[model samples]
Target: MRGRQLRRAEICLLVTVAAVPVAACGSERETVERPTVPRGMDRQADSDADRLAAEKAALDAYAGYLAASRAASGRSDPHAPELSRFLADPLLTRVQMSILQAKEHGAMRTGTLKSDPTVTSVSLDSKPATVEIQDCLDATGYRLVYAKDRRVVPGSGGGRHLATATATRYPDGRWLISSGAAHQDQPC
Candidate 1:
């Protein structure tokens, strides 16, 4: 019996030694390192993508707004009383008053003619809406053109009579030029 017990203990020791080598062999193999980028670089990429998306959205909105305005003009008169209703504001009112005063001062004719200006294109930024005017003519001593806004000032004629205009939205969901100046650098 003593001989048999000694043989069993030796067998167990041999099995344990063999299993140790197998486990150690697996651990000895090298693990490939993962590639990594700096935290700041990742943040920059995210910021750039966000900025590009915002710019694209703003440009798309401007394009849609211009398209609708052009369609409205084609379907109706540009100088319609309804159209002018959208231009209600202190600035526009002042412009109308100035034009009346100018006409009275002999700079323009007292008699006004009807004009229907066509818009070719329109671009809007944060502060102004730039417009491309077509089919314009002088009527009632006023230049009927596709301008940023109606009511042009003297000595500011050129480039479709580039007038600076501000747009607003009404409670009835209508868009219109709420206010405008003759130019960007100077006011009409």
Candidate 2:
């Protein structure tokens, strides 16, 4: 009878030990989930920031070009060295030609050409990154006057003009105006 009781006590001890573990595991609990990030996303974010900076630079260059044009218009020779700083080939040549024509016609601008530019679109994946800008030109107080007779030139009455420019980025990271067009007496 003593041995049987001892055996029964051992069985109870084992059962209690196992049951304790089972009871502990059986309790229900809520699990929390965490957000996971994919690899290389950080690098992509950096690339995007760089692309935006490049686009802004391009837009700035376009604005500089317009400013240069405005300055050149007021000069007797219509040749402003600062104009080349913002322009690249083809467009540079075109601007120079326009300046020369103005000088030959003895025309000089009498007022400021104010430009408010907005970036329309940008593409950074291309070999030469491209940026497009739309500009609202306020020439309401501006006029092109003949140097000799001081008469206002036809179509020189500046009110409002709409202009668009496409700029390109060089390898050295300098953005330059490549092509642009302007419409006189047009709304933005």
Winning model by TM-score: 2
- In model 1, residue pairs whose N, Cα or C atoms come closer than 3 Å (at least 3 residues apart or on different chains), thus clashing, are 112-140
Please state every model's RMSD to the true fold in angstroms: 16.0, 12.6
For candidate 2, report its TM-score. Answer: 0.73
Error of 2 at 123 (Å): 1.0
Q: Write one digit per residue (lDDT tens) for candidate 2, span 1-188.
A: 99999999999999999768645754433122323447798679888898789777987897788778777877854457888899987788888888788778888777777888888988888888888889898888788899888799997677887988889988887899989888864786
Each model's C-alpha lDDT?
Answer: 0.44, 0.81
- Which one is best on lDDT? 2
How close to the true structure is residue 108 of candidate 1, measured as C-alpha lDDT?
32
Count of backbone collisions in candidate 2:
0
In model 2, where is the ten-residue run with the lowest total lDDT? 27-36
Off by over 4 Å in 2: 1-38
Score every model by TM-score. Answer: 0.31, 0.73
